[model samples]
Target: METVMGNGNGQATSGGRAANAPHSDLVLPYGDQRNDGVVQVSFTLPVAAGPLAEEAARQTMKLMGLEDPQVAEATAIGEEFTFFVGYGKLTRAVELSKLRVAAPMWEELDQAAVNQLVQDTLGRPMVVVGAATGSDAHTVGLDAILNYKGFAGNRGLEAYSAFKVVNMGSQVPNEELVAKARELGADAILVSQVVTERNVHLANLTNLVELLEAEGLRDQVVLVVGGPRITHALAIELGYDAGFGPSTRPQDVASYLAQEVSRRMLN
Candidate 1:
């Protein structure tokens, strides 16, 4: 792969061909670049489309320490307001290589190993109840993890011989999920939320945790929450045993769930 410089402006100096490198050979441009605090942000201002609106957008970016902000796109949103999309070169980049994030560190284990461990230790299948709880009606995420066929070439929880997985589908109320878990003698409860607008998912997730704690089931079951925006740190802070984010593979959840179950049993 050949490397080309990006014009001090955001555009690539060479043709588009120079920027589209294959993932295997791609190199970081900021490998040794110093960190700067300048940043670029884009949002719609509830103002008319004209010189004044453009000036307001630039001023907002300037306040955020962004220099030479350019309004790349603007559109009329309504009769009175316009939506503006801007791009600015941010002078900031964090030292990601030096950052440390705390999370569960478990050895990867396959479905067979996970099942065998459950049978050997718990003497029964690991019961799990999963649902896309709250007002979020998306079921694809939960189905991908609980169904037997699975996603991305890895088998899901239903494929494990020692795992009894029940998927309750989407838009399930939190009270119903807790009731089902108790009825099924579940060892773990997996909650999926995809609708995040207005932090609705956050409130729903917190509500589930609060409900489980009220019912004295918070510690009895491994409570895991997953979504496109959910992070492990966010989940831990929200009183979950673990959190899986977008692009998470089936084996990642399986490995974590199996290890958590075993750990709980031992304790």
Candidate 2:
């Protein structure tokens, strides 16, 4: 029933928009009814689970600009921790057209096309060195992109004749990955890691870049990173050429490598 100035686009002055307003990319959280702006949120507080804790949760939601915050449940997790679930009506709308999202612009190619492109451009299989660098022992993400079996019914780079994949499994040091990439004359290097608390992987990913730069291989190799926590924007911010997040298929990586290597060689 009320409106406020919102973030992004600056046109979202109506979290609960008028019933007859012309729709032009304005959006809000929907719950029981259209334009209701109802949202559910769950969070844990350091206070003990009691009436005070429940009230604190409601107050927190109100502080977040939620109207009519209704605390649904409060449970104790530990000696001094309480978890609360609540419903609230947000009073801010977002203009979708003004949102800036960072993503890669590349043409999708199938396995056959990728293979043909590699053949036509390099006249040899593209060497790809992949590993789960640092103390991150997660290999499921790396294996899905580099292994022959692939993931989600799509064949990985190993199955593509265009790519010669050397998958160095989990817990590999950044030094080892760089060395392996150099030893094999890899055209691309993929590092996978699970992002941890305080973004511990940030140091490791940056360290890898530093190593590559020091080795005189940064410009020659296409550096890519992947994991559940990885994003194209984040990877680039960390000095990687590309980044793959969860649900990315092997074909996506292969196509990028094929096109990137081809483009570099051509230029």
Candidate 3:
């Protein structure tokens, strides 16, 4: 993706343009530097929708180093609350090259390798139970990961020769998921939640962890959560082994599961 990074004066470390020049179409040299001067900011503050509110929003943008901030749109989210979409040019650029995120990085193996790994490591097929738990009705994300066909260009977990994946579909309750895991002797539990409104997903995730802890299955099974807003930090806080957010690839999940299972066996 193309990105632009610059200082307040339009001067940037990027091999090109001023930090604030109208706009620059340059792909960030590094992941950290790719600050595509675009953002979808939303805020709810107690203010009336008027010139004063617009000015306040613009001022907020300026304070954030957004030059010539423009209030593109404004509306009322609820009683005594106002929302604004401010547009502006950012003066700061990120040093993309300095970023070092911890994540699985490996080429995906074919069906044969997967099957061989399962047979050699687990002495049988690796069983994984997945579901879109909580009140979330969206099944597309879970289906994309657990179904054999997969999503995008990546193959789903079920397509792996070594994996015996069972997708329980969506809207599964926590207790039911736990029961299913126990019944199926699942080695891993993959939970997906896409809805975040009112923090319902958080409650659901927390409950699942509690259930696992109560059942003495917390350490025995690899617990993973994924969603549009889920993060590794949040997952860890909720007692999950790992958390995945939007744009997570199937190979990434598969590699992590394979490595983690192997690691656990050693201990």
Highest lDDT, which number?
Answer: 2
The C-alpha RMSD in Å for every predicted model, in order, reads 10.1, 7.0, 8.7
Record all residue pairs in model 2 with backbone atoms less than 3 Å apart, i.e. clashing: none
The lDDT values for all models are: 0.77, 0.85, 0.75
Best by TM-score: 2
TM-score: model 1 vs. ground truth: 0.71
Model 2 poorest 10 in a row by lDDT: 1-10
How do all models score by TM-score? 0.71, 0.84, 0.71
lDDT of 1: 0.77
Clashing pairs in 1: none
lDDT of 1 by residue, 1-267 (tens): 122343332122323232344332323333234233333356888898888888888887777767688887777778667777775555544333343354443557887888888888689988999999888889888888889988888888888987888999999999999999999988999999999999998899999999999999998998998989987678878888778888777787887777778877787
Worst 10 residues of 3 by lDDT: 1-10
- Over 173-217, each residue of candidate 3 has an lDDT whose tens digit, in order, gives 999999999999999999999999999988899999999999998
Model 3 alpha-carbon miss at residue 99, Å: 5.2
Clashing pairs in 3: 10-18, 10-19, 10-20, 11-19, 32-96, 33-96, 115-162
Backbone clashes (count) for model 3: 7
Error of 2 at 242 (Å): 0.8
